[model samples]
Target: MGPLIRPLRSFANGLGLAWWARVQTHGPDVTYWFGPFVTRGSLERELPLFLEDVASEAPVSIDHSCLRCRRGEPFTIPASDG
Candidate 1:
């Protein structure tokens, strides 16, 4: 086990899907917001403030920032898939 982020573990478990199961099903469009970041067989942070954004009625922007590397990694995941 790793020093997995507890909120993520609980949230992922709440979805009733294994870590890899989500990947196989949703692939890269996998919303880490309220989704899991599995680290070495365990989970990490459950995307703080992300779920709130998801539930909000306001518009959301994915390209607002380059989150992962903060360098805009030049990757994109389509919203239609989500």
Candidate 2:
């Protein structure tokens, strides 16, 4: 299942049917898109690890959601400090 996840995710992403973790953080004011998961269950299972890594940075606040949608390049979007 682990090995197959990558290829399955790729296929689903190609068809614009992939699951994604949309993580938003305050303070730094950034939005990070983390995944082209083939299933929502898989995304949910893996979200905590990603969140933990991000939490290490110490953002003012954190918010997240699971989304099934197509996404392109440049997964990281940081809000302008200006």
What lDDT does model 2 reach? 0.92
Q: What tens digits encode model 1's per-residue C-alpha lDDT throughout 1-82?
A: 3566566555544554424211111322323222333332332243325434543534332312112211111222334632
Q: Tell me how far the alpha carbon of residue 40 in candidate 1 is from the true structure, in angstroms, after superposition.
A: 10
Clashing pairs in 2: none
CA lDDT for candidate 1:
0.33
Clashes of each: 0, 0
Q: What is the C-alpha lDDT of each candidate?
A: 0.33, 0.92
Q: How many clashing residue pairs, candidate 2?
A: 0
The residue-by-residue lDDT of candidate 2 on 1-82, one tens digit each, is 6788778888899898999999999988999999988889989999999999999999999999999998877899999878
Model 2 weakest 10-residue run by lDDT: 1-10
> What are the runs in model 1 whose C-alpha is more than 4 Å off?
1-36, 39-44, 58-82
